[model samples]
Target: MMVAASEILKPTGQKPAALTIDGLSLEFPTYAGAIKALDDVTIEIGASEIVGLVGESGCGKSVTTMAATRLLPEGRYRVTAGSIRLFGRDPFAMDETELQDVRGKLVSTIFQEPMSALNPTIRIGRQLVGVIQRHEAVSEAEAERTARGILKDMLIAEPERIMRAYPFELSGGMRQRVLIAMAFSCNPGLIIADEPTTALDVTVQAVILRLILDRAKRTGTSVVFISHNIAVVSQLCDRLYVMYAGRIVESGPTRAVLEAPQHPYTQALLRCLPERVEPKAELEAIPGTVPNLLDPPPGCFYRPRCPEANDQCFAKPPSMAPAPDHIVACWRRETIQPSIKASEATQ
Candidate 1:
């Protein structure tokens, strides 16, 4: 029986999403107890779309993406429920050999801290060329040529010099750009940028973001950009998901979420932004600390920190779409819906 690759990839008879994480719940087991890292996290990204995962530290943004890619250490964690799909294929079902073929070829990740990602001993050019050759069956000359072209696209000066230099020789910005170039080098369908610009200066961060956006647009690649800075994501992402503790409290188009966030946690996060406060006024901070994952609080994870929480918030809220394409999980959706409508009317 002969079967085309397209048919095998699209068994459902529809164009598959770039990435899908459906009702995923995960935990890390320790000697004392298991840590609930992600709970019912669901997200779907289409081809060429840029999605942002934003939250405070320890909010499971990194864990969710790492789980989707199966980069987490085996046996150290468990998926209690749910499924992950990359281009309609289950990552957890694949063996190491299959994962190796899928990782760089189908999906790639641009991690934080470029210095840690790159090898200190190898010249930048050779490293880039090696990655290009790994997933692609190209000659050394061709790989080197592609590496140089991608470096040029990153707007690096003296591509030849950069290729010859070691990882330690490049500045922080240059090193991050090299990493971005490497991520796009394989031309994967999906790219997970896990806070790629968090280490750079503000100026360099803007440049790095612009380069990523432009490259992804040109290549038609879907991007999952993880960050703690809501403002940064607002500038780069088409859609936004706001995570609190281990659950997504709000998710919608970037403009809609920014204009009228429905969840109390989301509203508090936006209020804490410095730009939203008057000059010299103290910036508002979300009260209360993130609950310990080992034995998380009952019901809504954000209830403790949410000032507007009522008795009803003691129970977990189901995810609801108050407006088309905008989903939020919060107990106060009924009351908040009117405010969202009012904001829309005013616009």
Candidate 2:
């Protein structure tokens, strides 16, 4: 369907596109010129699927989210071209009233820091009750009760007491639990969890992850879990999409991608996982830093750091053609030596 289309600075629609992004592009105008935050990006999340958005910092991950949600400040960034559709309808073209109806009720976000996401001065119960009533039409007392119930599911020892306390009174993990509670309260079609566990201890991180995965399963909620950690994604996501310099370099089923990485960037990511590999073992890092978004490499963004880069790699953007179910944007997919053969070749 040709959904409503909005102007560069406008926002549009409510229903989720099953959610598809077609030829998406976003840029920021600076004194120098335009910094390309996203370039010809395309992705789709099926209903109830947990798809991951994986990348190192500055790969345009967060920028992609901000643009998708129309959360960007006016005039600060620009959507030069493309569509952000939910349910095949244009979110950009939706009017302000429609946008408000869609954003939190149909789509919600869990930020990297809970403290930043929550109001420090307000009590947790008030915040939770307000969100529930805003979208759900529940009475304040009923919403407050629902909030306590969700907090209990997070395994909080005293959900009632915790709800009454301010965000500052709660621990970091406690605050995160409350965030998850709020997100679930709406039962949104899609939930964007951006680095959701970055602020807590390792033990608490595991607990929060389990709670997220468990609750998501029961709700059958489609999620876009953004993270720099591969191990965490492996545990939660059904599929993985790896980004590099504002484009997706690799995407596939989680287990297959983890076991047999086809792109050099994907390989480097797995090789750098400290938890899965030995502590004393030498880690593999892509040699160069990510290229400047303002003037990204002419061809492949990862060409400078790819060990197997060839003359052809510098001449054109690699195609993300299908290789089984996985789509890879590397010229060396066929050339990647099998792990077993590589070991023998080394010997």
Best by lDDT: 1
lDDT score, candidate 1, position 90: 95
Query: Measured by C-alpha RMSD in angstroms, how accurate is candidate 1?
Result: 5.7
Alpha carbon deviation, residue 78, candidate 1 (Å): 0.4
The alpha-carbon lDDT assigned to residue 281 of candidate 2 equals 77
* Candidate 1 runs further than 4 Å off: 1-14, 323-325, 337-347
RMSD of each: 5.7, 5.8
Predicted structure 2, TM vs. truth:
0.90
Q: Candidate 2 on 1-347: residue-level lDDT in tens?
A: 11111211011233243577767889899999899989877777777778888998988778787777788887898888878877566878987888888877888889989998998888888998888888888888888888888889989989889988998898898889989989888888888899999778899999999998888889877788999988789889988889988888877787767677788888877666555455587766668788988888878889988888898889988867655446777777788842322232123
Angstrom error at residue 71, model 2: 1.2
**Residues 188-307, model 1: lDDT tens digits:** 999999999999999999999999999899988899999999889989999888898888877778887877778877777766766655679898788779999999887788888876
Report, for every candidate in turn, its global Cα lDDT versus the true structure.
Answer: 0.85, 0.79
